[model samples]
Target: MTQVTLDDWAAMPRNRDEVSHGVLVAAPLLDIRHQQAVTRLAYWLDERLPDLVALAGVELLLAEEPLTIRVPDVLVTSSTDLNVRRISPSDVRLVIEVLSDGTVRTDRVTKFSEYAEVGIEHYWIVDLDALTTRHAQRP
Candidate 1:
């Protein structure tokens, strides 16, 4: 059987929910709690990073075919790419994943490695229940 790659997976309509650590990432609906948390944090970051743009409910396609991964939550990037299409993970400078019971590990471990591998400058994991956030940076 042929394996599906991230790009192929990206082309396929996604309607099923998947687990990304402790977070439950579902299609069609974006989580309210996660949205709120992202808003608050983005506001905090905006005060400092004036040239940066905060994006919510956006898709980050990290790979093509079977390796394709779409991240939901928040991302910080330069204002220039805000109007562009199909932003690649290579262009992503920072990624923030809000933690929930279904996808916490995926955020903390899986995505951490993936983001680092893709050369993302920073990765943030926010634990909603704990009311805390963890930031990871790559050198």
Candidate 2:
């Protein structure tokens, strides 16, 4: 498998690929329930944080060499620019992931660490199976 850099990942077509530890990986198709959760979260964030931007499925570039990238289900940021293909961790205020059977481990472990390392203030994991939301805040 060929390693992919952040720039390479960004240049690819949207909703097509992701980089995991510098390796290119295909993005999984989101199920209807997951989509619904992301939509609802975006709406809720928009209502509560009018000054910030809430987006769904946007690429969040976390690291450079041995590149790491993740697309959160829903993300809240103060950035106003919509033309950017990838966003830096500094621009992100919060990240939310709607748990699916295929991504439980990555969301809870891999992404959790990456988000924290980048100093993201808030992280939320919504587990549809358990009907609960787990929240984490950086100190």
Candidate 3:
């Protein structure tokens, strides 16, 4: 199979899919609890950080060449313009991923490393099953 590039991923229809290191990964549908978690988080962020915008399930471009694109369950950014479909990591202030059975590994490992590598200021992982939230900040 041919490797997928960021341009190729961007051209495709917006769906529950992500590209990590040029590999396509399918994301499971968000359940009610998952959706609720994302909503609560977004709301909290909006209230606390009025200057930043909170978005759910938005595609973010973390790297280039062998592209890495991720769709965080919740994202907080200062970017006001919505014309761009994919946002650079530098523009993002925080990335939140609500843990689901199908995405635990990717969220905790793959995405964690990717986000850190790109210098994302904050990363949050919300575990609905455990009813907990884990926060990580770049060192």
Q: Say which candidate scores most in lDDT.
A: 3
Question: lDDT order of candidates, best first?
Answer: 3, 2, 1
Model 3 lDDT per residue over 92-136, tens place: 998988889888888888888888888887888877766654566
**What CA root-mean-square deviation does each model show from the true structure?**
4.6, 1.9, 1.7
Question: RMSD in angstroms, candidate 3?
Answer: 1.7
lDDT of 1 by residue, 1-139 (tens): 4455544444666443432332334644547876678788877876777877777656676655334455556788774756753457776778887777666766677778877766887777777776554555462
Residue runs of model 3 more than 4 Å from their true location after superposition: 132-139
6-94: candidate 2 lDDT, tens digit per residue: 66766777783568789886767888988898899898897899789899888888888889888888899888887997788899988
Stretches of candidate 1 off by over 4 Å are: 1-31, 132-139
| lDDT by candidate, in order shown | 0.64, 0.82, 0.83
Model 1 Cα shift for residue 57 (angstroms): 1.9
- Candidate with the greatest TM-score versus the true structure: 3
Candidate 1 vs candidate 2, lDDT winner? 2
Provide the TM-score for each candidate, comma-separated.
0.70, 0.89, 0.90
Which scores greater on TM-score, model 1 or model 3? 3
Candidate 1: Cα lDDT at 133: 48
